[model samples]
Target: MIAVPRAQLRRPLLSSVLHILSVLFVFDLVFAVTSRSLFSACASLALVGLVAAVSNAKYESLREPFVFTDLSLFSQLFSHPRLYLPFLSVGKVVAIGAGIVLVIAGFIVERPVLPGSRALVWLAAVLPFALAFPVAARLPLTLDPYVDQCRNGFFAVFVAYLLNGLRPATFRRFREVVAAGPFATGKPIRCPDVILIQSESFFDARRLGDEVAPELFRRFDDARREAVWHGEITVPAWGANTMRTEFAVLTGTESFSLGYARFYPYAFVRNKIASLASWFGRCGYDTVAIHPYYADFFGRDRVFPLLGFARFLDIRHFASASRAGPYVADASVAEAIVAELEAADDDRPRFVFAMTMENHGPLHLEQVLPGESSSRHTLGEHASWRDLTAYLRHIENADAMIGRLLDHLRTSDRETVVCFYGDHVPALPHVFEKLGVNPQHSDYFIWRNYGADAPERRNLAAEELGAALLRVVQDHGNRAEQPHASEKAT
Candidate 1:
């Protein structure tokens, strides 16, 4: 390792010191309010430790340091531990739990720091806030969370981003873009029902090794051959944070354009924006969103309406859906799509956007059950093979979901188009390391029924997906209105 100069380390060290002092001051405030030793000095340390533990785990999995926006997900830690907890080692979890217990026990036995007159106690409590204000105001920050996090520490960088996220200038560009309005897809003589599926943590796994089964993505390969457009797609997220990719594809907006709001775009959205749903709605199509998880997980329930979705189908709609491990199975989502189409009695075109939850990760939490095929013959008995095995099992269901939908669309008299893509690759860092592969992109395809197959491969950024689909739709419409030379002469 290269040695760093002492000068370079000074700022980071000072930042850590300030962060510790802030935590202590906050604990003192709590103790003053309670007028008991309920908030001990040890409790402050425990809180810092917990934040550090979570930050490290997230960094390892997602290649992103924890920021202020991540605080929005604290409730999810309790609501969905399986999704977030597995990233932390069991030892860290146990140690953090023990630390919290010890801190609480100290509250009962410890003595108060300011055991004096009520006026004096109140003065002691209020003094810290006054002192803290100067420190916070003087805190030098670059305001770039990823870089500032290293120089000014987690807490300071977190607060910096939080402050910046609230600034009006940060959203000025996005508001301007939204005001410009939706894409102008001219009036068409023919319109087909559109079904867009955002598959979770999906990538072509056969690229991992030659020992991998060729039949694994047979249905995916078949779809590619007949697709109007098919290829890899670069998304704005990794490991998790499905909404980043989701927002990009739906609105055709780059995440960076939102500034600090990019971390959780939905939370910042208060006005209607140009999006796939809004555009479709304007064209007289009934726009709907389907996801087998809580609609409010990422505030999608409130935000979907803003995006022009006429109906939002969430966990409530999938109460009886089949499960693959802990999530609603991909097959169940496919079934729901078909059910939605059949339920619509009117001849009005439909735009169904489904976000499938199967193949979501924390894959290491589950094991390969008995009789499951192993990739070890080629991968040679590594620890990560289990993750690969678990992934393959769930992916089989995803492939089956694709095949089933394609078959249904082919047989239906009503013309329909299916645009499918993965939000991001799975959180299988170890599996990727063992296989000597580091995938940076996920797969996508746009296929339509009632058309001759002329497959064209086109790779794109996540934001470009919506426009690309529209282009395909418009090309078909243009061709439909054209007359042959024989007809023109007549």
Candidate 2:
């Protein structure tokens, strides 16, 4: 028998306690940033760890369900830090670093983070799941509606649910979901090239006639006249949450069906379901997703493929000289899309989904003094509306981008269809209060170089826009049996 000193045994125990406290302290502080209460954050500690692990992998800023759904996205972000490192906040970088330090300290320091012996780090890691049992689910009372007195014990319940999903009885339902049908069902039309512009905060402020000068929206007004389908769209999110609109348009999934996933659809769901891209892929169109930002933003880099995009053109794909203000200018994006269309001039149909980022939030800009408002533009006194003025300037630039894109498509010999819409309203809290603008509704216009007249302006949901766009595409000779060189692999 081996004898151990009391001092050594006591020291290790104290170290273990301190270590656990430190781990809790770090996560509680980190999770507190977004969680409503510290208790809720602590209760979801394991969930926090799971989110943090994925966030660290993807160079992402936050750890909502959207960022945690895919580990592969993290690996993609890790492989190309250059694309996203600059986008992360200083606080996020520090917190992530601190978490790593604590994790390493657990293995070597005074005590392990796990409950058992300090030397058994791996066993400690598995202890929580190993200890969770079915009997705990039968507890008499519960604090949270979903779980019993145990919080991390929720993991055991989750495991049970997962196993239940994999049971023989549920196999038929799983197969049914996987074997879904097509989107564009009409006579397999040889579709014309499709271009969808998810413009950043590009709405016509002219609607607020009293608040703005008519001259300010001249370019916006000019672009609207060319639309085949013009109207306002009620998006899922109010001021922000771009993914909600993106998901709705890509999959044409109704807002009510999204539930909690509405906030970040890119993260929560991992099914190989049919979408616009999948439908386009089936028809042999070259599907491409273009966005002037980090490839991993919202895990788009990984999700695009699942959505059936054959290629993705991100910020790295754009030249540095193309930048205007906070991001690659809309004009540059317009040029890039045209260039791709021209490059694939071999007559193969193309479907390009381009997301613009020139007008992102934090609209703090130089204040125009009381009387110094530019006489050239008619936005009341500009100094007080510095942010609004800045936004309008970006919108002006976006209008130019729209004109360029439409002009290119019009001049091209191959028939084309384009849908231009804003993802959501700008999160200008002050502006929203001052102007009484309904940020819930955004503007959208579908334009084709050559097509029949569209219905008068009408209101529609974001999810309903794709089906409408497809109906228009079918009319304009969609699905041109020609194969795009870029998508030869498919």
Q: Which candidate is the best by TM-score?
A: 1
Model 1 agreement with the true structure over 209-250: per-residue lDDT tens digits? 787887879899999998989999999888889998999898
Q: Which residue pairs in candidate 1 have backbone atoms (N, alpha carbon, C) closer than 3 angstroms, thus clashing? A: none
Global Cα RMSD, each model: 4.9, 11.7
Task: Quote the positional error of residue 471 for candidate 2 in Å.
Answer: 0.3
Candidate 1's C-alpha runs over 4 A off are 1-8, 12-21, 24-28, 34-40, 113-146, 168-189, 375-377, 380-383, 477-490
lDDT of 2 by residue, 65-140 (tens): 1221233345655775543454455666676677656544543443312223333433433443333322223323
TM-score (C-alpha, index-matched) for candidate 2: 0.64
Candidate lDDT values, in order: 0.77, 0.60
Name the regions of candidate 2 deviating beyond 4 angstroms. Answer: 1-188, 269-271, 365-384, 476-490
The estimated TM-scores of all candidates read 0.86, 0.64
Model 1 residue 477 CA deviation (Å) reads 6.0
Highest lDDT against the true fold, candidate: 1
